[model samples]
Target: MKAASKKTAGTIALNDRREICNVPEPSTTRLNKRMAELGMCSRREADDWIARGWVRVDGQVAPMGLQVAADARIDVDPKARGQQQEQVTILLNKPIGYVSGQAEDGYQPAVVLVEERNHWRGDASKTRFAPQQLRGLAPAGRLDIDSIGLLVLTQDGRIARQLIGEDSGMEKEYLVRVTYGDVAADVQSAFPRAQLMRLRHGLSLDNQPLKPAQVDWQNPEQLRFVLTEGKKRQIRRMCEQVGLKVVGLKRIRIGRVLLGNLPVGQWRYLAPQERF
Candidate 1:
């Protein structure tokens, strides 16, 4: 038997079937949050577009703090909604040639080193750098192009903030090889069995002043230095000022984290319990 169509007060077209329905009172959810729930874009992106007057809800412009019914007509401008959502974090044992962030005149940024094959899948091997995890990942800290060491790229802002924030207590350790112009006899005597050296009163020819440093011999030619703050070309400059020319400089650790045997140009995860 064919059903009779009642007087249509309102209509909802679902799966190509037109059905008569009552028009319930309109309800609302915060526009920015609603946009994010739809997975269309980030909440911040929605807020920016709404302020630019580009988002429309129920066929009208959306204003900040304005709410709209969940089922209301909503449209994001063509140019507004960006590309597919993919967040990635790539830990790279950055080699000497690549810059840390933006491109320089001829050098490529390190982020490009992450290849599709490295994209992290749930599998152990694939989780190294996942395609889906690439969305908002960025370099949390920096490594000089001339320096080879551990570099971290991450989507976690809290981790990034903790590691590189100005007030961060994280320590960066380096292995430096130095060649001195004229070795001070006292320094050579102090250097041999010394686990620590203080350059306070200052090293002078009569007595040259050197900044205090915690230095330890890694080998006859190398010294390990641990510092909490990083300044531009700090180690190199410090070595030069002390009458020692730095022939090689490598960052071997950051906080309790070691660059380890990851190999040059390779990277791995800091174990779950690892914290800076």
Candidate 2:
């Protein structure tokens, strides 16, 4: 007839079938890690919430470094959510001579341009500028001090992770002006098609093979590159390998966000409706 089942300490026995199945215990993960996995906040933010008693697990206040089951209920205090909402993401038209991150060798960082006076007048975002927003504000991605274009700075951890996380595959588009040896104008016609194909794939950097990229001629002297990974001065270095020298490089887009007529050295708040 039907198999009769019985439960033992760590196994389930089917009497008629003479079969047994092991019952494994639920796996546990660190409290902060579990919270981050759920997309609630970053691990650092989760730890801060736990320390502030803003996080609860299974209806009890979660302690720092606590281990929790995957199914455990996580409740975040309203204060934590309010603080997250206050965080801001700014898009800047970074100009040359400014480093993307920290000030180095007497060069100012791009974030210094995010002051009230530099706010884009054409910006339609309703968010007002506040000095407090500058605290913890850092670049989400790097744009070399010598190159200029769209650069992102933010106080929101989520945006930082979204833009530069290890697994992130966001596309960054650039317009690169290049010249070949003695050919500065109309170099595209002189450049071989096979070398252009090599730029699109089969290129290696830092001893590692680079992911395939979208590389094409934007004009006679300019090449348009769309890459999902950002290495240090990647466009310049990539041009060098193909017997081309980069004269100018500008990042035009990141994900779906564009540099779009935002004046150089000016900044604007990322609108709520815009993503990426």
- Provide the overall lDDT of each model, using Cα atoms, as 2-decimal numbers: 0.64, 0.91
Q: lDDT, candidate 2, residue 24?
A: 59
Count the clashes in each prediction.
20, 0
* Model 2, span 27-138: residue lDDT tens: 9999988877777887888989999999999999988999998789999999999999999999999999999999999999888898999999999999999999999899
- Can you tell me which runs of candidate 2 are displaced by over 4 Å? 1-26
So what's the TM-score on candidate 1?
A: 0.56
Residue 222 CA error for candidate 2 (Å)? 0.6
Every model's TM-score: 0.56, 0.89
User: Model 1: which ten-residue window has the lowest total lDDT?
Assistant: 1-10
RMSD values for the candidates in order, in angstroms, are 16.7, 6.3
